[model samples]
Target: MANKPSPSPTWDEYVSELGRNLQRARISSGLSQEQVAYRSHLSRYTYQKLESGIARPGAPANPTLRTLVTVARILAVEVSQILPAAAPDLPEP
Candidate 1:
């Protein structure tokens, strides 16, 4: 038997958590992944990957402003609610 390859490491935990939050919000808003994808101008595969936590949310594929706005519009909630809060402090450049 051959050893299976490991899955890609998620870029960030915050993105993974955000994916969960988005899914919950979507369900609460009574919309399917496909519906959100279509309305958000994203492919179903992209949306599925996002909801499944396979893709990192708020990253390149996941952090599209269009997606956040679409989700907010569909869920009737503020974007901040679904997305993780920003760090309160940042190191100076």
Candidate 2:
């Protein structure tokens, strides 16, 4: 039998991508996790959780717009760089 193609990425996948971008940016800047968190005005533990790809245990990391912009500023990366190219579909508010 032929293998089936995977379905579209879920919200969790998007969150994972964001985490990856954050890690890459931090590495490129030669900044420690603690440094990034502190500069971003986030707690080290909370930053660790985001870098680990979860907002909480068994949950996706859906950061608020303020948080995203703040982290991007600290990392010197564009917000678009930290966001997945494609995101899960959501109804218009």
Tens digits of per-residue lDDT for model 1, 1-93: 999865444446556677788899989989998998888887889887777666644443346787787768877888888876543223367
Flag regions of model 2 displaced more than 4 Å.
Answer: 1-7, 90-93
| Model 1, TM vs. native | 0.67
Q: What are the runs in model 1 whose C-alpha is more than 4 Å off?
A: 1-11, 56-61, 86-93
Q: lDDT per residue, candidate 2, 1-93, as tens digits?
A: 999865657788778888898899889989999998898888998998888789888898878899889988988889998887876655468
Q: List the residue pairs that clash in candidate 2.
A: none
List the global CA lDDT of all models.
0.73, 0.85
Model 2: how far residue 80 lies from native, Å:
0.6
